[model samples]
Target: MFTRILPAFAAGLLAASPVAADTDIAFALDWRFEGPSAPYFLAIDNGHFEAEGLSVEITAGQGSLDAIPKVASGAFPLGFADINSLVRFLDQNPGAPVTAVMMVYDSPPFSIVGRVSQGISGIGDLEGSVLGAPPPDGAWAQFPILAEVNGIDVSTITIEPVGFPTREPMLAEGNVDAVTGFNFSSYLSLARLGVPEEDITTILFADHGVELYGNAIIVNTDFAAENPEIVTGFLTAVARGWSDAIADPLAAAAAVIERNPAGDQELEGRRLELAIEANVLTDYVRENGMGQIDADRMDRAIEQLRLTYEFTSEPDAALYFTDAYLPDAELRMIAPE
Candidate 1:
């Protein structure tokens, strides 16, 4: 009932679409198995990929930038990663074979998680406080733009280059006043570390003035060119998987736990819910279906990136994302929260 549009409009057309011979796909993820990944696991379990004539193996990654080179190198045919990072990678590499086929998170999860008790109730409050940032972190990489747009004085802030493993724990222990991370990731991780939920202040970059996007599904250009039908089918299945997750996030989280047994189910479920409500299902995506980017917004994002990263070449939005493989609107629609 939460799904606003009836999907029957394109069902017949999608059924008539040419089916690719069963293909095996190796998918590289941006981070370790977590709540956000449940949709892909659900895709495998719910027969979405099988229905698309594809068998997929999703590999965990080290960080947001981890999948870019792997997918670009053709070590993996497809990957999920940050588009901002991808822009930088492509600008630097100049003829990389990888490009984003689908936009997964309409609004990015990049955020600054701080303790309210540490006087980090808002963006300006970040001044004169310790900010723990991981060098390779996608969120931390974009902190400068978030700072520039929000008018925060970076000089007053003490930045600590922390490791990913110690990021949230250091904040929970009050070792650092705040930490840069994904909204769903750091917020829930701190709660699990026994930090009071009310004391945690999540400053999502999207909610602020930052006009950037989040992670997306990317594919090797050569692979997509050689197997166009397979690429389309894979993207369709991925969209279906996300729709299924939006329908029942708790069940989706359990699907993730099936593969990552060491993970805490309840905490992951909460994390999944956080991701769904905050990042995945944005107002723009609610009306426009998933997996497609807004050109004007993407242009704004590129301009914002210029504030922090110096592009080696002029940025091209076409080189970054192509919606050629996205499923029809009906098929891409997810249930609104």
Candidate 2:
């Protein structure tokens, strides 16, 4: 049966050759392997990365902001990071030489979840409200910039760091008017705890002019240039893995479970569901195919980062990303109807 052969086949492929030893690559994760990392697990489980002669060792990163320095210092050849963190890193490091290979979420998942009873419909309504935010260095630091673009005064908002444990309780117990978090992650958590859909209001940052990418595969520019074939092969395998994950998210989730047995099952399940919905619904994949990046969008993202964050100088396009290795044909492969 296919099921019986699949696991063995995957194992064989990973062990088949020492090519990975010769051209080994380390992929640093932005966080612990949970929902957002299912595709990488799927690729490894299905022998996709192995087929490309890539021995990818995936390690958990401290966080997005911290992950940048490690990648820039060549601690890892590849890393998964958000566009905001990447931009900030480039601002500080100047010529660090890193580039995005592909985008994961077409729309950044950052959002403010408000209790509907408070009548917080948009960013404009948040003025004078108690907003439970992550720390200054946390993901929520960008919310002020998002508010600024939408013509909302950032000073009118009161921000208090909710730390990590108090997000759901703060929102449910009326301790905070709104909380900053990833819609896919936090919304699902709330819904699972019986938060009514009508009571939940999500305002995505991308809708308000903070348009930026999220969870992209990044590489060292020098490594990509010197080992073009290796880069091409790795991307091709990743594309195949992405298509496979899209075709069967259940299988992808299972792959993730196989690797991280201690991970939250319900959270991983919800993550896969949301990822599939976001991936299929976006114009990023529908028009240009999966893993496609638009130059205009990239420019817009860069501009937003520069203007909003006040970069000392323009980041070199070459240092941020390259599409030379993106497999055009492979990216277009869709599941059979």
Candidate 3:
């Protein structure tokens, strides 16, 4: 089961990290313009960033790991990406100069999405089936852990290496039994492709045996050092944006609609609502607020990673995340609706 942590570091979090000298921020996103990306747009439209004396430009990325090298190389000072992937990147590169500043997805949406018609309904049905997985997908990277904990032999499942554009299509067309992706992303995508809601089966990793965290706001260490205030302010704005988004998902999707003219408002709105319920509005976030991590759970996540990823060097939690830049608890607290 997914771990729901207590408030261990709330009141003592922020020590007033102010805006950096450079108010202009180049932020990168982990995926394209979708429902989950609404909060950031809300932050921009609502003037939260401007209120904090910061001007932010968010760029869409290819995948979870796509933003890592960009931030590490200083091509972007800030980015959103999978923290698990970040850990591996740090171990592989050693001193890459990028780390997560805010924990956004308390319970990740990683899942194996399938259709009942494909002779699949649960994780048990995976054997003797083809799983369409994008090589760069965050969920595919973590499939080994799910398989290990559940005692499902991965070798029995045929993995079809598919591109992101084709992953959901293959599953919807019955060309593959299932696909590994984020719960909201894949489920909604399949529905968009005319897959019946009754036929789609989403087995979330968090619901199974995985205790991993999800995508987070990452920053270049060099930029953070130079502009601690800017980083803090940016995170504060992000928290506010998410809070507002939770309160009014329809408005949040409206903000997204403005950016992507080709997107369907109704579909995007429903997508935002799904993400809010499944990924964002968690028990821990409701109780302890947002933008921080549970140290004990993080330790467990590292141990779980050891099941598949072999670290080149010892893992350090300090290098991966820091709540020092988070806003004060009062600002971060998300009231339950």
The C-alpha RMSD of each candidate to the native structure, in angstroms, is 7.3, 6.1, 7.3
C-alpha lDDT score of every prediction, in listed order: 0.87, 0.68, 0.87
Ranking by TM-score: 3, 1, 2
lDDT of 1 at 259: 84
**On residues 1-337, what C-alpha lDDT tens digit does candidate 3 reach at each position?**
0111122321111222456343666778989888899999999899999989887778888998899988887777789999999999999999888999999989988999999999889999999999999999999999999998899988899999999999999998899999999998999999999999999999999999899999999988877776788888899999999988888888789888798888887788888888889887788888888888999999999999999988988899898999978998778876555
| Error in Å for residue 321 of model 3 | 0.8
Q: Deviation in angstroms for 146 in model 1? A: 0.4
Clash pairs, candidate 2, are 98-319, 99-320, 99-321, 100-320, 100-321
Q: Arrange candidates by lDDT, highest first: which order?
A: 1, 3, 2
Tens-place lDDT per residue, model 1, 22-79, is: 5667788888889999998889999999998987888888899999998787777789
Off by over 4 Å in 3: 1-22
Per-residue lDDT of candidate 2, residues 223-262 (tens digit): 6666666766777777677677777666577777767887
lDDT of 1 at 288: 81
TM-score of 2: 0.84
- TM-score of each prediction: 0.93, 0.84, 0.93
